[model samples]
Target chain A: MKINLALAQINTKLGDVEANLAKHLEYIEKAKAEKTDLLVFPELSLTGYVLQDLVASVAHKPVEDDPVFKHILAASRDLDLVVGFVDEDSRHRFYIASAYLSGGKLVHVHHKVYLPTYGLFDEGRFFAWGDAVRAFDTRFGRVGMLICEDFWHASPPYLLWLDGADIMLFSSASPGRGLNDKEKLESARWVERVTKAYASMFTSFVVHSNRVGYEDGLHFWGGATAFDPNGEELAHGPYNEEAITYTQLDLNQLRRTRARLPLLRDERTALVQKELDRILNRG
Target chain B: MADINLTLNTDLARDILSGFIKSEITRVGLSRAVIGLSGGLDSALSCALAVAALGRENVLAVRMPYKASSKDSLDHAQLLIDQLDIPNKTIEITDMVEPLFQLDPDISNMRKGNIMARERMIVLYDQSEVFKGLVVGTSNKTEILLGYSTLYGDSASAMNPIGDLYKTQVRQLSRAMNIPAPIIDKPPSADLWADQTDEKELGFTYEEADKLLYLLVDQRYSPQEAVEAGFNKKFVDTVTTRIRRNQFKRMQPPIAKVSNRTIGYDFLYLRDWGT
Candidate 1:
């Protein structure tokens, strides 16, 4: 199947949820016009990153009775929308999350697991770590969602691939500065390389979306990208520029790539699991 | 090894350092200054500038080493003293700091680190009292930006000559001074913990981080612009987050406003005290 994917790169303000939602709705309309089968957005695209303490107050809880998300559910009735936001659980701990919407209902939500704590990041200070990886059944295919820093590691994407996700989508709010354009592009290239190598290794497609804007002394570099099931670059957006780009990915090519490279067929998961156990134990 | 640039050359740095010392000394009306010499680049640079401006006899270099401090650091610090031939003394602080740790065994590594820093500062300040001198600081601009130094510990000083220079720039000045090659080439550390390195804790090299910081904080590059300029987005985000998160460390403690112009309240005045 040939699937149309859209990457929305837009500017966002810190703690401005309503304005950011309005922007997301506008972008959704644009993506709808392009007739995209899937639409992806950057991390924290709703309330922006570096909102500090405001995350507790502004984070949205996915309630069946909540009107804001109800409106999103209504608007996304016809299209597949993947957007980033903050989710508040019952424990009151906030999570960096990506919501998947399809056919006017909430399909699945994935919480960010890797909370960066060192220099220039206090994610550990503000948000709690998520425990599970979620995949959803979609009209295009079985899709998986990951937040920023999730796709940086190879394990999450590999797990999603194993869980029967034919397409993997990443939403990120990657900061930009000093030769960061090349760095971001190179990083994207690395992600593409890994996804393609892994996609060919696993027979899947990978799509990534990033944001653009300056918030609290940091700038988000928007360079949304997509790789085919064969791990080739199907499309890429400009770094630091707000844009929406689309590409068509054919599912048939995934089978061809998988057939050509049958690495997954002859894999050793037990040994890999043992190695993972060793790494985690060492940590 | 990266080629270090101060951005401000030796002559310019000398002028800036001298001017900062002269103005601060005049403002405080102090003829003598005391420094806690760690044998590290930051302290060495600060002590050198202080000696040049106030004369060797007026500047006191106090080396306060604990149990964990490397002998190389002491030897290098002695080399700086002997080379400059400044008035100096070595005070073993292990006896003083060990008791506090014994009293509270649950004291965190962070707390222990702070105690080590504060112990040294206590010695420096006590010496200041004996010598009638002001405590000169060794913190650099990068440390201040990241809030890496301990407040009232390494962060507390009357004035810092090298506070405006980044770590990369400090290395440049160190090289220009022909200060021993070992001191210039050695990795930066507080020596609070054995085999500890600053960059390892910070998650990026000073050269990479300082360049990112200069563009983000100084040049006002947006995160997107920074990424476009070839910096890693994750690294950029990390550096920018640190700068924002540590903003509190850059300012005086917050106080409830009662007066029209309290010290850190409405009374916020320009730091150009002497000028």
Candidate 2:
């Protein structure tokens, strides 16, 4: 049950949704050539991040309604693709979402939960938060999907773990600043450590992909990484560089690790929920 | 429309300041103006121009502080006021801001920082009413081009004197005016949060960012040309993208085109519209 995963770190042009989609298609072809079981792309890969008001004009409807998405779906008939795009709901609110495509069918969509409104980021001004934590059943395994800032929170992944997801994929378009080198490294290390810990606890493989190159004032530092079920770093990409990182994961090895670890089986959900409720209520 | 140009020298700076202040005053029809004295170089130079145009008594300096603001910022602000001998007042906004934060604890530190900035503006505008003066802005061209100031916060001003000068040019002008060297050399900051610096948040030194910006925007260099000119491609792209992305912040709200001569919709006027 070994599967290969490919993370595409592509530089995207801002506001050029068509060009970006073309770039994504090219990368997908490259990933397919490399015999990738799952191909992951960075957040907002279709239109680029920080488009400001342009997101309102350029954001597409669901996959069925969007012609570009239809093309992507048609091209993805033979590949398992995880790509980010702008999704506009019926209420006209846009969302930063990643679509999972398998066998030319839309499998699942994960909306980015955390809309960063801090310095140089105004995602909140343009996007609405997602409400569901979904783990779709795939041929490789039970795959859990989360967008950037979604994995930043502990609750969503923890919930997906409880839903019996055997593998996790996270995508991001995190920007880089020169003075924030230490902060960036610390955040990357934190993501790695937390995902690895989650993987070991749930006996799952975790794959994370981020964009590279500069968009506006923010530089997307591409540091895509992965961890096996035993919480070991399998592969990592270079920071501030575009790359396609590949890793092979064995589900049989994950099962063996789960059996040996036995951490998930001894879980206490009711108590955890109660404690979480208490904390949320306190705030 | 002959592409107005001036030499980057002390005499030219003084002449430009004099003309700019008079034009702005005449355009707004306000005899007095109020400025938030942060004791930073931008404000010191702005205060000097305000005094030169409206006299020391006609200019009012307001010092607003939060709890975590550095003592040195307050001291320097007071020193500038004393040196200029302008009528000024100090107001602490910590108490006003803290209670609001207590009501909504989920507000992030970043949002809280923005709230502090807006609070300071609220005081400035309020004092503008009290003193019957216009709120003078101190933001330089570098910050304005980069969209570094908070919109409707620090960016909200009746009129700005140094909005067209780069940060390096501001320093040069400050030296010509004989303003304190400490103010000019100090790390530029908004003093929004404790130990927060602008260059730290922007990720590059002001000198580098400003020079790079001048090359790309003013000198009309393409991204490739800027990179070939010894600037990092990533840095150039970042600055250019920021300027493009934040262009909306620098203009009036987008309007629906209904009238033939609407203010921002159809009838386009230069910045010195009334003047």
Candidate 3:
């Protein structure tokens, strides 16, 4: 099966949900025009990232009940969307969350795990950690979803791979940092290393969408990318600008890679299960 | 693996900062700036950036020298003024502050230094109105975190062009911009009292503090992690404590929250939308 995916790298304003929803709709239409099946936006695309205390003002339920969700549902009849927003539950607990909307409804919702409280990240101050990572059936294949810091811990991807994932999507609001003497974006350079390695390690396709623009002085460099099961980059987007990159993925490659490596065929689940039980018991 | 180096692309950094100055000021519907030129590297760099952004015509460099301030301070400031081709003024602050010092007759040097620092601010802000320009701040991230500066004194300004840069980074950029060697090389002094260099007063050199700070703040290492990374335990603890203790100086006076939308909390909006 062949799946056409579009990565929407956009600059989101802090605490401007309506304006952000408008940008999302515009990109959704553009992706539909390109005949893309799924469109993905960066982390917190519904409300700009690093919003400190502004998260309280913009937090809301998933697209189902959100006032902005109606417009998104109307636009999604032709395409699927993976967008990020600060989610609030019935009890008013806030979470850094993302949703996969298809055919005018939310197909799946994934709350972010590993809220980073260190260095440039303060998600712990504003969000509750998500508890599980699992893959669900999409029209294309079994797909897994993970937010920015979730990708940092190899366990999430490992669990999703064990659960049989053919495609994985990652949303990020990473700031542009560590420029080199040649004026290259150093953070993107490092991100490329991890994305490529993860694709090869899991033998699954990976799509990463990062945001762009500046808030106060912190800059977000959008270097959105996607990699095939063989760890080869299929497409790349522009840095420091709003861009949409389209790439076609062949699901057959996943079968070939898994057959060749036989990584999943090897028996390690029992050992992992035992170790996790032992570790948790100790805790 | 332990080393990290990020010397900014000097030309690009200069262009970016100058652009920021232009946009931020013009966004508020003003095009002119008033800077306190202290004949030191920080103020000199600030002056140079303002000149590049607003043009030499729109910048006013005022030198307010205290009684014990070195003659070289005035000369170095003049050198910058001549080089940048900006209008300059000299205001002696001794006459204005001596009366306050005499009232106590035997006040501590720390108290007297603070009086001078604040007195300088008063004159600078007055000139800001007469010149129809905003007072540009020169506080770098190092002094700001350390609380080495007197609050509402040298720290007062409408906006800051170099507040994010570390002292070490400031030195690099100043050198890249060709700041005078004397001002850049000489020991950093607030010139509150004679021989009162910043490093001496803080009991640590900027080169030393910058390395630890680069590890702590920029690299985001925990206090123990910093010590493990080869920094002195006491130094790391002292510097980090000062940063935490002085956090109040970093922000505006915090307001009580009783309403649904407070000014700084839920209502934090960009400058583009004016109240």
Candidate 4:
């Protein structure tokens, strides 16, 4: 099957949900015009990142009746949409989350399991830890979502792959840091390498959408990118600028690559699980 | 010991810094910037960047020269103003600061210099209000790290574009941006007194200091480790001591924790909150 995806690399106002909602609607309309099958926004697309004390105020439940999700769900009737926001549970605990809405229904909600607290990030100080990493059925295929730091660790995406996800949608509000001789940011280059490696290793399509513009002193280099199951870069957005990049993803590439490699088919989950159990419970 | 590479991709740096200046200023409902140009490299680069971000018409460069400030200082500033074609004002601060100087007949050079800097800051802020612009700062990373600036004087600003660039890095970028040759090549100075130059006052060249600082601060080297990295042990000790001693100049006044969430301690929110 072939799927059309739109990676929206946008600039968001810090802690302003209303203005961000308008921007999402505008991007959805543009994606629809381009006949996109799925539209993905960067992490914290609804409420901006760096919301230390303001996280609770911007948090919302991604239910059908939610003031923000209602418009998003309505837009999903035309095409599937993935958006990032602060998710509040029944007990008022907040998580950095992404929700996938398709056919006017919330299909999957992924709470970011890893909140990086080191070196310029303060997500752990304000957000509750997420304990789930599961893939769900989407209109395109079985897909999983991971926000920023979650994908930085290999375990989450590996678990998603084991759970039968053929597509991995990774989003980030990654700030630009470290300059290289090639004029590319160190952070941007590292992300591109990781996403492509994951694509080739897991034999799945990987799509990454990163936000652009500045918040406080942190500059987020946009540079949204995609890789096929063959680990070939299919599309790349501009660096340090806002843009929407669209690419046609052929899901059949997964079948061709996996048939050749056969790494997933030869997996031994039981032995791996037993080893992990022994390592954790070692005397 | 390996050499620390401080070279920046001027194109990328220009794009990022200009975007930063534009976003930080406009997010607060202001579209213009008012910068105090010292006819030195740092201020010249800051003014050029502000013009790039907010346009030449939006940035107002103000030259606040003291009586003892060099004639070349004013002329160099005028050359930048003419080159960038930005709006400018030359405000002589001699008369404004005379009352305080006259009050102290035995005033020290440091006190007089502080008075000149604070008076220039006053002029900048007042012109910022008149021009509906925010004050932009020009202190580079080297001086900021060494506490080479007077607190609340030249250090005060609504935002700073070049604060993170070290002195040598600032010169590299300034040359790339095509700042006037005289401004970029001349010996760095505060021009606070008749013969005041930064290196002569600090007793060290910015080149040597930048390398040692990169090892100590950026590379997180200890004083012993820096000495092992080919730096003199005394240089490392002096720089580290100065950095520690000037910690107060870098931070907000601490508030006592009286509530469940104290400001800057627990009640944390970014400066771009709600904007």
Candidate 5:
């Protein structure tokens, strides 16, 4: 099966959901016109990153009645959307979350499990941590969504893979920092390395969408990319600018890659779990 | 101490800084920038980058010269104005600061210099309103770390584009921006007094200071670690102390916390909040 995906690398207005929703609608129309099956946005595409006190003000519930999600759900009937927002639960706990919407209905929501609080980041002080990582079946295939920092940890993506996710959608509002020897931002280089490694190791399609533009002092380098099951880059957006990057992924490549090197079919879950239990109980 | 790498990808740095100026100024509901052109490398580089971000038409270069300010300073600033062809104004700050100096007859050079700097800021801010622009700052990292600027004087600005770049990096970027060769090659000076230069005032060259500071701050090396890395022990100690002492110049005034969410303590929000 072939699925067309578009990475909408957007610059969100800080704490203004109305403006961001309008931009999302415009991007959705552009994606639909291009016949894309799935459209992905960077983390907090609806609410800007670097939001400290504005977190509570911008938090939304991904329901049919939400002001932001209402327009998103209406636009999702023709295409699938993986959108990022601040999610407020029934208990008033806020989380950095991304929701998967298909056929004008909410499919799955993944709250970011890891909140970075060191060196210019303060997410841990603001939002509640997500406690679960699970894969859900989409119309095209079984897929998983991981926000930035969640995929930085190995266990979240590994859990999704073991739970039978063939496609991993990663999104981030990563600010550009640390110029490298190759004139590339170090954060971008490290993220691309890990995404490519994940795709090759798990033999699954890895798609990444990082935001662009500046917020306060932070500059988000927009270089969205996708890697096929063979660990080759299929598409790459421009650096330091906003653009939509589209790529078509063939599910047959997964079968071919796994047939040659069956990393996923090694059947070692029981041994891994036993070792993990032993390691945890050592104290 | 080991030599630290102070090299930057000038192309990437230029683009990043330029984009920062544009995004920040426009985000604050202003499309134009008002920069005080001191005819020095730092201000020249800042003006060029502002022109790169906001077109020359959108950037206003204001030259505020006191009575003791060098002729070369004004001439070099004029040269940059001609090169970029941006709108510019020359407001002599002698009259603005003379009254304050007259009130205190025995004022030291430091007080007079500070008064001049603050007077220049008043002119720049006044022009910022007239031009409908934000005040773009030109202070580089090396001096800021050493606390070489007057508090609320040269350090004050609506936004700074080159504050993160050290003095050495500023010269490199200025050269890249094609600022006048004389401006980049000239000995660095605050030009507060007739004979004042930054290196002479700071007791060291910016080159050595930049390398030492890169280790101490960027590399997170302690004073002992920095001395071991080859920086002089006295230099390390003095530089570290200056950074600590000038901490007030780098931050907003501390507010006493009484409420649950006091500003800057628990009432955390970015400057870009709600914009």
Candidate 6:
């Protein structure tokens, strides 16, 4: 199977979810015009990152019954979309989440498992942690979703591959920090290294979508990128610009690599399960 | 070809900074600005950025010189005013601070400098009410991190434009803004005491400090790692220690966290208070 995916690296204002939803509608129309099958955006693309108290006002559930989401749901019928928004539960507890919409329905919702709360980030104070990681099938292929900081750890992507995902997509709102020899921002280079290594190790296609623009003192560099199953870069977008990069992912390449490596197939699940049980019980 | 040459696109920088100044000032219900013009690169860059944002007619550049301040300082400041054609005033702070300094005749030059800084801020803020403008700050990221500024003194301002850029970066930006070449090339000084240069007292050049700071702070390299990256161990240790010790100046007065939400602790966030 071949699928054309669009990476929407956009600039989002803090705590303006209504305007942000409007932006989503416009991007959906553009993606549809480009004849793209799936479109992915950065983490917290609707509300923006570094929203300490503003998150409370902007947080909302992507419920189908709501007219706000109905506009997006109507637009997603022709073009599937993965968008980031602050997911407020019925009890009003919030989690940073991404919604996968296809066939005019919210197909799957992935809550961000990792909430960074260190220097330049205070997400732990504002959000409740998510508790699940698994892969499910799409019309294109079996897919997995990861949020910003979750992929920093090797376990999340490892679990995704173990759960039979051939395609992986990540939503991020990473800030640009430091500069390399050519005076380029450093974060995107490290992310590219991670993307290639993950794709090659798992023999799966990977897509990373990021946000851009200035929010207060923080600058987000929108260098969204994608890799094929063989770990080669398929498409790359520019930095610090609102860019839409479209690329095709070939599912046949994943089949070819998995057949050659057989790393996932020849695995001992029982031994790993026993270790995990012992580790959890003792902890 | 240095270890980290951070040269910004001046045109882009100017636009981003002017936009930031406009938004920040207008959000606070003000269109004008007041700056403590010290004839230094940091102040010059801040003044230039303010003019770009709020025009020359709206910016009030107050030159507060002390009894021991250099004549060159006044001349350099006037050069900028003549070039920008902005309204400026030279206020002598000798009478304001001399009364306190006289009480303790044995006070160190550093103490005297602190007195001068605080007194200048008082004059600027009072003028802020009169001029109907915010006090745009001139303290750069280097001085701020190293705590080379006096608290509640020159550090107090309604907003700061150059606080993120290092001292070296400030010079580059000043050149980008077409500031006078002599002002950019002059040895840095607070002009608190005669013949007092900033680097001579600090025991380090800003070029050395900027390079090490770029690695240790911005790049997140350990002090030992910075030494490995070709910086001196003494310089790395000194820079890192100052950054850690001087972190208090970066934040507001610490409130005792008694409740779940305390102002300046858990509440009164920047976005909540301003934009």
Between 2 and 3, whose DockQ is larger? 3
Candidates' TM-scores?
0.54, 0.53, 0.77, 0.98, 0.98, 0.79
TM-score of chain B of 3: 0.95
lDDT for each residue of candidate 1 in B110-138, tens digit (9 for 90 to 100): 88999999898889999999988888889
Number of backbone collisions per candidate? 23, 2, 0, 0, 3, 0
Q: Write the per-residue lDDT of candidate 2 for residues B99-149, one digit (tens) a residue.
A: 988988698878888888899899999999999888888889899998888
Score residue A252 of candidate 4 by CA lDDT.
90
Off by over 4 Å in 6: A180-182, A250-283, B1-36, B47-68, B77-135, B164-181, B203-248, B256-260, B272-275
Tell me model 4's lDDT, rounded to 2 decimals.
Answer: 0.92
Candidate 1 — which residues are off by over 4 angstroms?
A177-201, A274-283, B1-275
Shares of reference contacts reproduced by the candidates, in order, are: 0.00, 0.00, 0.13, 0.75, 0.69, 0.06
Q: After superposition, how far is residue A215 of candidate 3 from its true place, in Å?
A: 4.5
| Higher-scoring candidate on lDDT, 2 or 5 | 5
What is candidate 1's TM-score for chain B alone? 0.92
lDDT of 3 by residue, A1-283 (tens): 8889999999876788988998998898889899999999999999988776677788877655679888777777899889999888888888888888888888888899889998766778778888989898878878999998898888998888888887999999987666435465577777777888889888889989998766656667788999999899999997767899999998899889888987768849999999989999995
> 1 or 3: which has the higher lDDT?
3
Which scores better on DockQ, 3 or 6? Answer: 6
Prediction 5: B-chain TM-score: 0.98
Worst lDDT 10-window in candidate 5 chain A: A176-185
Model 3 pairs whose backbones collide = none
Residue lDDT tens for model 2, A1-283: 8898899988776667788788888888888889998899988888777766567766875465587888788777878898888888889888999998988888888888778887656778768988889788988878898887788788888888889888899888876432211334445667667877877767788888898765423446688998888988899987766789998887888768878888788889989999989999996
Q: For model 4, how does the per-residue alpha-carbon lDDT over B101-131 read when each residue is reduced to its tens digit?
A: 9998999999998889999999999999999
Global lDDT of each model?
0.78, 0.79, 0.84, 0.92, 0.92, 0.84
User: Every prediction's TM-score for the first chain?
Assistant: 0.91, 0.93, 0.95, 0.98, 0.99, 0.95
The worst-scoring run of ten residues by lDDT in candidate 2 chain A lies at: A177-186
**The candidate that achieves the highest DockQ relative to the unseen native structure:** 4
Greater-DockQ candidate between 1 and 3: 3
